[model samples]
Target: MPAGGLDIRTFDAVKALAFIGDLSMGQPTDHSLRTAWLAAQIAGAASFRADICDTVREASLLRWSGCTANAAEFTNTFGDDVEGRAAMLAERPDWAELLNAQGGPAQAIAPLAQIHCEVSGEVARILGLGSETEATLRHIFETWDGNGMPNQLNGKAVPAAVFVVALAGDLEIFSRVYGLEHALVLIAHRANFRYPATLTIPVNTHAAQWLDTLAQLAPAALDAALLTPQMQHSTSPDLIADVLDLKLPWMTGYSRAVATTAAACCARLVADPEASERVYRAGLIHGIGRAAVPNAIWDTPTRLSAAQWEKVRLVPYWTSRAGKQMGTLDQATELASYAYERLDGSGYFRAVGGPALGLEARILAASAAWVALRSKRPWRDALSDVAASELLRTEAEQGRFDSDVVEALLEGEPTATQSASPRNIRYAAETTRLSSREIDVLNLISHGASNKEAARALNLSPSTVRTHVERVFRKLECTTRAAATLKASAMGLLR
Candidate 1:
């Protein structure tokens, strides 16, 4: 784990999803994380199984994960989705009035329907969630009285996680926006209506305690327990998936899938175990940078304007940043970021030729593209496997993908392995050297620590922590914490 906080992976996937949720609705940030913690406590108090508690926490984070993927539609009907959501929260309205405010119902139905299904599906698939969990997310908006979106699943049809998350989410929001007493009252009022009556009281009670204990708990206390020993023991494949997903919802489980696919492909090419593990880890974090990007750009349904596209292109940079913060991922970060580059100078950030690109990078690029194409998107339906293959082939012929890597990817061939081939593993010559304090700050940042949290951990003022963060970015040739972390990992400073 990095200094400022844990590596993005150690926390529950739900926390990351909740971050996206908070961003989607423009809520006071950290609402999702707080809510998730509350939900976990509620689950424990209610005597839910340990697996159920974990599931509840994960669901709480994912409940709103899909909300951002449909931002364009929400913005179109509501005129700025973020602002509209904020208004709705400030003044709770009747369902009828809320629908009417959503552009007189007619214009809103399609977008709303699209939002419900698309978001539900995206969140579930991205997390590699089980069908039960997916069903839970799909029915998150259902009412006990049989009025909700799509198919109205009433009461028991909803999963326990849904009930727990819903109750906790509402409780946290109300408590933060209003007061603890008011939050309790609100929870009581919504019981059996928006909430499952049986779970509401327990959830609300636990939430109240959480709010009271807020000051006493360590910044990392709740999150620290969510991770498994494997994550800390060694950066396992599942650990990588967890880390990437927790950092960026859009990239939930993305690295894991890529790692699995790439390692399988590479294994056929060679039998060196260490090389295989390295290749796998490389695949696991290829999209960590996607976390630094706002959900608005990531979930937009329409074609990105030129400005938005630039933001899209920054995901790799952020991935590299997180790697640098971890101390031993600098080379991995570079390969991850360059996964988007074309062989013919048509790629982003850098346009280095295919020959110059690493074999790991070429496979990562092809695998990422393949997975993305086959996976559904807000604007377009997912492509068939054949269609995705053809697209990769087209890019390869265009001089974007490496010829051998493309063939391997298309034919299901293995990653070519030469016995521990020499590779560049240092920070770019242009990268600035950060001080030890700056590196510490960067590590805390990659773990999602707030300035206050970082300050407390390091015995520094919030203002001082912020200053150190700024210095880290300047010296590392990066801007965000995610980027700085990746730069450090590239330099082996984060380890």
Candidate 2:
């Protein structure tokens, strides 16, 4: 795909995570990049060493990395997770009032924050960031006064780099969301709480000048900071797919299913291995931009309002922007951005006709549509393969999908396409060292089964099943169920 074999590991971990983090936080796509840039400046001005400044920059980029892991909880706490979190970040005037109306204490976010911290920390660990960066991210939401999320550690107990990053984030977010005056007011209000006064005071004095200068350099400078050639531990773009799918439970493993089918279709129809592999990668991340929109919009069964639809159309545009920050994933994500386009010029973000579209674009679009058709949606039962094929063929006839691509998906389709699931993946079971019973348990839990549910299905006691699940986690070296599932999938042990 990139003049060599499909080397999936070359994905820029910072860009992929930062893009997802920004979307989950309801900030602009470059929000994390700007935040990281601001954090580095603050850290630099504080006379921190270059390495510490680098940690601050990276910590800021991944500040919201765990946001998706807590999306459902956030939606339950606040109707619109995106807007609610965005409002909280900007310290909107009515944010306090809105929280009061919820009749929930500030501490309610602790559990959500705990989940957030653990997942973010694990992501950092998996990405091979240093222990300091991981530690800083785990404490990113904490404050100096101990009125923070998760641990609530006070006054110097938190990592020093975190405070600098926090102050920088405030300056960047408030200055952009509100104005410099209100931003300064907000930053000053948080002195001795959000960060040490030593780090906080100078920002109020120089933020205007700093932000003005940042505006000139932030675009190129921030991009350079966020986009790297690769990480020490190479990461897969599938991680991006996994993290995004977490925001919606029903969509578990959805990306892989799309990818599996897309690859198979491309291989059969196009007969180009490299092109097929590229399509597969695109399928895995086609919905990364869907993170920018809230769960509420995607969960809707009915037609989206005109305003809501406009936001949905920008999904592709956001995906493309993320691509720019992604180093090796540049082309794959660009292909992903076109997944929604239709050959009839009836698609969104860009409405180009059949003549302008490439074969890979057509294959990805068809593959994505077919996957959606076969997969279950909130409003309806999953369509059977036959039923999905009928609908897909109808769309192809109407010029919405490429007829050949649609036929390729329908013809050479994996019988397990609906479950185009991990069931069929090769089992390097010995590699995971999981026993048959443990494999069965891991498979069940990975599909969203609870311990009791898995136990019942396996005809084993819940305690035994719990023990087995714990063993699976230990062996897989995962903490969260999502992490366990991902690792198990990667190990080909999910089956």
Candidate 3:
């Protein structure tokens, strides 16, 4: 829905985040979006301002945004946070059930509630929500009179969005678990205190029957949704690279650190403006595919099985898929997809020869490997800087990575400390939007087809195709076919 296609501003942050809540709640996919829509309708009917209703809708969808930030921590504390939330739909906990059960359910449940609330508030703050919005999110679980954890500000002080979102969220859960009739009865009973009397009256009035109204709506209502143009788009080359780190809570800082180190390594190379930007973009989105992989695998400190390794290999592939739907990002996507490839054909998804992998991609591959080796993951503690360097060199010697990029990373750097600050790096690289013809030419170039072959395929004369290829090369800054390939890959030109 963004004017320039699928840049950062194209994807609705609220809608995308609702998917996360759906995952956390163990709901059928897209359940959060539907619940959000239903909640917005309820808010609209309750004399709420249109913008406030929209905010409530947005908050309903994104209220669980921070849950992914600490998934491992949550899983550790509660046997399975994902599974526990799933159970909430059908089962009501009895205090007597706790008294008769083994160990401490009450103690565990309280902290989990507090942790979820606090983390949600933290994510709201990080996303730059307004103060009123932040306050609403913080008190999402508060009872009207007082009892919410992580500090309850009580009734009137709570943001309207929070009150509507909380009630709407629970109503959906209840409706799904029990019949709609039961859900409405429950809301009517809770009306005065737990539910705001004004909002509760309408939800009890229409929502129980209107639950089926969503069926009249199409799927991927989310697909048609738009992010406002006012949101700042991250054009940093590290955009996708840094995004990968956000796949889990504990990894919040990993992608940014790796991107910084990788950019520093690339800085030592020939500074073609286009190539520099391409490499940075590759670093940011390189790990976005990790979203398809479950947090269970990501958080495991133990070794992985063959099945897990296969799942791991698919992350880059998925990252590429995510980019294709976005406009004008082909080069960045391609680089991100192939970031794991090795020169010796040891990587995944069609293991092409070194010629297909391009210089920019090679730099990204090496940089990614170096940063990954240096960072701590579930299976291992971070390697010493010296050890990480040795590992990179070992890979280079085996012809798996570009020696030039590796050398640049190592130049004037015997010790492996942090790379240059990401904040200091200039991201003012000029970007030209690619036209359809240019995109077609670049896609063929990525396949290692010559200009003549591309011309035949596109029904254009060789001269015209050559001109386009030359322009693409100049715009992307590559003298050789390999560099062009890297840029294309970074932009996600390849499928």
- Candidate whose lDDT is highest: 2
Candidate 2 residue-wise lDDT, 186-223, digit = tens? 88888988788899766766777777776787455656
Model 1 C-alpha lDDT versus the unseen true structure: 0.59
Worst 10 contiguous positions by lDDT, candidate 1:
415-424
TM-score of each: 0.48, 0.87, 0.64
| True-structure lDDT of candidate 2 | 0.76
Backbone collision count in every prediction?
A: 24, 0, 30
- Assess the local accuracy of residue 6 in candidate 2 as a C-alpha lDDT between 0 and 100: 47
Better of 1 and 3 by TM-score: 3
Error of 2 at 372 (Å): 2.1
Sort by TM-score, top down from the best: 2, 3, 1
Tens digit per residue, CA lDDT, model 3, 277-383: 66665666677566556677777798888997888888777667655444445567678788888888887765764898887778778877776776667789888
Q: Name the runs in model 1 displaced over 4 angstroms.
A: 1-16, 89-99, 103-130, 203-206, 227-495
TM-score of 1: 0.48
Off by over 4 Å in 3: 1-32, 88-106, 113-115, 171-194, 197-201, 204-252, 266-275, 288-296, 307-314, 317-337, 341-345, 348-361, 397-399, 402-405, 412-495
lDDT of 1 at 128: 52
Could you tell me the C-alpha RMSD of candidate 2 in Å? 3.8
User: In candidate 1, what are the lDDT values of residues 266-323, reduced to their tens digit?
Assistant: 5555565555555566666666555445556666789999987987687666555544
